[model samples]
Target: MPRRAEPPARRATVRDVAARAGVSPGTVSKALNGTGQISRATRDRILAAAQEIDFRPNALARSVFERRSYTVGLITTDSFERFSVPVMLGAEDALGAGKISVFMCDSRDDPIREKHYVDVLLGRRVDGFIVTGRIFNEREPLDVSPGVPVVYALTPSSDPGDCSIVVDDAAAGRVAGEHLIRLGRRRIGHITGSAWFDPARRRAAGLAEALGAAGLEVAGDPLYGDWTEAWGRQATHILLRSCPEVDAIYCGSDILARGVGDSLRELGRRVPEDVALIGTDNWEFIAGGARPPLTSVDLGLSTVGRLAARRLLEAIGGNSRAGKEYVPCHLVVRGSTDDLPPASTGSAS
Candidate 1:
């Protein structure tokens, strides 16, 4: 048998894979790194060719994906407030699953502090960033150099081109309205946060749209105020006074729902039996603590963080996406709207 020829001294390069696979080096890289969109057949052919050459992807080659810092900076202007906590937790969970570390920074809604944290994170060489804020409004994009990927969560970037992940507030409101409508409640009322808040207005609009689609309207215009239990109580009084026949009420937040639930009791209305109540942000504590338990909309905050982390990973891998992405919202039913409350003290609570 003839002796086997010795291999070349230099290791095979991406060019070698491209030539063998009959594709370009860029396509070869994308296929190997799972970056760009390539047909499965081509990708498989490229991978096979790469393996046939005994090609080894070294750190330098991997660096094509920005050096695999495998780290992300999660900056929030809400100081880890209740609204932002679950998002952070979900993001951390996802990034951790991918063996990526996260550096959390609270900008406290201060532009100067946010800039400082951005600079520090950049110095630390984070591969990408996920900027979050309490309000569901468009905000100024982070001051970062081009090609350094950044994703906005909850709070989107004013630059519409930037990628943003946010809760589907409209969907939440629509779901709540549909749920109430399905229960045959035509005289519905709404109590929410300040109209100045984008979420407040969006939720109110969604509720109105859903009600309108059903050929009905809210018993009265949505009462807008701050997101406080006190506001909930006061708004409840006004909603009741204006719409005495109101059968169901939708609140913008769980806190507000809690207040409304208490005021409903004081006004001698039995939940679901006499009137139904629903709110947003299935915050377990407030929802569970509320009398008769609160039915609320789970805005999928964790889903927002997880999706943001996933998007950042793709961005770091050179498959960056743009525009706003809305995470779906869910309903958490409890005695507040259910005819019979759950017997166990679990998620239903």
Candidate 2:
């Protein structure tokens, strides 16, 4: 014969909490939902009562009452790679602070997939959206309801009226150029990706501007090719062949810089001794892993994401603005451009 088990206690409700606080259920609702104003002391009492009983309000029921899901849709065309991941992470941090959940979707650069994601997220009734991509080019605006807010990060919307947060590509190149100039390295050569890419053209222009301001000029015309190590190696050979007097080189990306450095070593050019090197993107895995490390410019990708999140939150709050907003770039110095000890190498604005 087994002893009968005792019955479990019933779960507490709003009514129970209200009764314990000596107030009506309506007052408890106001305090819990932060809706109608209640006296500070009264609110505190109700909160304490709810806490004492370990009361957990029903989020689903509350969302229905408030008509807000407190959730956001984050869509990316880059498949969450090197560029979009940081942006998404930053957006998540800001949205999490607002007590909002995020539904991440990768479109894989497919228009049909992106449309499907937009439809699904709209069906879920997300509060707003944050759209991002790998490149700095303009993309078509998201196909969502007119009133629903959308903020673009890293990639601007084709519509000039939409809100966009992007990196200052020109600033990145200028910063690198100025740093090399500070080290008294004139006759700087520029090597980068395709001229067709907006970023590559902007960076080249920025470098030329910086050099012009210092009463100098680029050692030769910018050699643009693909954004690959092989292109970088090929471009370096072409640049050195034509401008052997080049005392410094600025590369569009750290990968390109690595190739340039390898080529320079083969040509018996000592980094920072015979030729200083500067790369963009400050990608630690590539820049920090180089033989002598690389002095590179950071594009502030995460900052762009955070700003986009903030802007989207503002739009959700009925305060929205349009147009592009640029985040500044910074430089991280290393042995490739400086003779300082490894321990002393750090960031410079």
Best model number under TM-score: 2
* Tens digit of per-residue lDDT, candidate 2, span 1-349: 9999999988889999999999999999999878797999999999999999989988788789878889999988886388988888888888888788999899999999999999999999999999998867888899999899999998899898899998889888789889888888877999999887888999998999999999999988999998888888888889888887788899999999999998888777778787899999888999999989998999988888889999999999899989999999999999998753212111111
TM values, all candidates:
0.79, 0.89
Q: Where is the poorest 10-residue window by lDDT in model 2?
A: 340-349
Candidate 1 residue pairs that clash: none
* Candidate 2 off by > 4 Å: 1-49, 339-349
Q: In candidate 1, residue 12 scores what lDDT?
A: 87
lDDT of each residue in 37-135, candidate 1, tens digit only: 999999999999999999887654464565666778998988648867888898988888766788989999898999999999898778889999897
Q: Give the range of the ten consecutive residues with the poorest summed lDDT in model 1.
A: 340-349
* Candidate 1, residue 122: lDDT: 91
Positional deviation of residue 121's Cα in model 1 after best superposition, in angstroms: 0.8
Residue runs of model 1 more than 4 Å from their true location after superposition? 1-66, 340-349
List the pairs of residues colliding in candidate 2.
Answer: none
Per-residue error for 80 in candidate 2, Å, reads 6.2
